[model samples]
Target: MVASPPARFSVPAVTQPRINEANRKSVGPLSMPPRLLLGPGPSNAHPAVLQALSLRQVGHLDPAFLAMMTEVQELLRYAWQTDNRITIPVSGTGSAAMEATIANVIEPGEVMLVGSMGYFGNRLEDMADRYRADVRTIKKPWGEVFSLEELRSALEEHRPKVMALVHAETSTGACQPLEGVGDLCREYNCLLIADTVTSLGGVPLFVDEWGIDLAYSCSQKGLSCPPGASPFTMSDRAFEKLSQRPGKVPNWYLDMSLVGKYWGAERTYHHTAPINMNYAIREALRLIAEEGLENRWQRHQANAELLWEGLEDLGLVLHVQKQYRLPTLTTVRVPAGVDAKAVTSQLLNDYNIEIGNGLGELGGKVWRIGLMGFNSRPENVILLLAALDRVLAAAGYRK
Candidate 1:
């Protein structure tokens, strides 16, 4: 044995390869055209918000950052018109916040009633199903709003733990009225979740008055901030349901139990927060605060009215009826033989303007124009109308 162990086999040593630099390309400085964002969302961020985004970043746990976090929550409360202490900004886009609300409050096997009027409503059903909820969807055609009676019937029949509705259906330019929905939900002992992504800052949203137990919105849409930090609020009743969950929240990242502690007085560390996005959102909220909600809402309404009149003058019909039409986003039916994409493309390429194409069933059949947040201006309305006239004429479509 000693003789056999005397000589061990030696392995060959290969030389390491050097880095290849020949194929590497150096990226140039950032540059882009100044575009008028008239799309369904992400209308131009306020200049102050853009400036705030460039300010130095800070540690997530820094005291200054924590104070800013509290301010952001306060601003969100103002924007949502709610006094709920659970209001905070989720560190993702609106959909993440939407999922956070749906996943936490509705447990597996619990029924969830979805009022599907447009794309976002159907999306809510999808998100609810992903959480293994017993989903029951009551749908209306696209470009339509759900009546209170319809929602009441669905809630009574399904007896769901949650009733989800879209406050503003961006996909169809319809605003679902929430005047009595909260009362209806209360009568059924169900939580009300309002998707306010397109309504939050640009229009009237009385979270407490409307009795919405949970509501979620995005910065990019109505707050005029980049699409990252999204606003979310949970009523005490909703949080109570979340706290009493038999099992841990299915999503670790969106667990309100853990997230609440960080955003609440506990100030615990959960995840590294998006500091710059928070800064941008904070400044955006400040802008909202300075302008006041009523003024902002009026501004949006005025601009939208102008747009509606202009579109009609151009012989374009609106998808949603006037009574239910959304002030923030407008969906126009593509003229009988017009190409929606071609119209949008021409606006982008020739005019540096951006508008959204229809989603889901309405794709290529309509165009979505947003007059929201900072982009909701009379001048913008006039400009977009003029641009559309030129582009449509070029497309050989007569007014």
Candidate 2:
């Protein structure tokens, strides 16, 4: 026993290496807990979508991948409810899609009449300006919808070559009525363009019926996919505009005339398409197809009604009027004494939930809640109401 005790070996200290110039930027591994995504975008991806993304990777130009891409284009056509041959997904976020539509449609020095209702409406105006178009805005108060009269007056006054509007204003939860505006644009001989980023899939978006010449949407919002892919659809008229551009589009990455070749029958290469993201988008569209368009719209409408009832029961004021409120996104007035940011932070930290704060003029004055696609469910409505009640109570706001 004494001899055995004397044979023990000492252990050496294991030291981690210090940061060197080459490795200084390297970060440690990250761990993220699954949190409920109820923000303006990036709602939860469907399980099937997640499964699709996990499938084996293939070369970007692989025949199978290209076949899948074609299927995706067709599926997007169904989701967009359009037969436009040039419809395809751009390899970027919603903003890229918006830029692509604008760049393709507007020539330098062309006038673009834009609606200024909230943040995204302002973004359209800015994009028009960047593209060297003379931008004219029909301004409406934040949290308010623009009337047909308002849009008609703007069209009469500006006579812009292109009229741009946000079908669903995420910032103020306002859904602009497309029926009259589209007709007005037709009457004015202006190409109608819309940002449907927050309305697609969750709402009834009829590109052809609305006479929208060009429209774009993100996968993350109503499609229940990740944010890297943006679905863009264009009418033949808009494509003709692209064909007749006096000069090259400002952004090559978004040049539809060239990009169409890759997504077209030619199977040419514009850039490396995001293969995995396409898979996710395909799966997301599949889910929407299974749900059926009318049923999906009704589901969103029903969930939004529940949310409205709950918020009203709690004595909260909805920002947008009943007729104009977006079904997928709701904006509620931030009570006078409550700190909107604090309530949002508590909801995120304590409940593992995310909600959006108001944007632009509505900032610090309203809270924007999204009930989009997969995130629009009865359980989510209840969860949000209960959590918000707790938050408001703690903030000394009476229920």
- Please name the candidate that would achieve the greatest TM-score relative to the true structure: 1
The candidate that achieves the highest lDDT relative to the unseen native structure: 1
List model 2 lDDT by residue over 300-332, tens digit each.
999999999999999999998999989999999
Q: Which digits, one per residue and each the tens of the lDDT, describe model 1 over residues 9-48? A: 6554555535345533544577999999999988899999
In angstroms, give how far residue 248 of model 1 lies from its true place.
0.4
Error of 2 at 1 (Å): 41
Q: Point out where model 2 deviates above 4 Å.
A: 1-29
Location of the lowest summed lDDT over 10 successive residues in candidate 2: 1-10
Clashing pairs in 2: none
Question: How high is the CA lDDT of each candidate model?
Answer: 0.92, 0.90
Point out where model 1 deviates above 4 Å.
Answer: 1-25
Model 2 CA lDDT for position 325: 89
C-alpha RMSD by candidate, in order? 5.8, 6.8
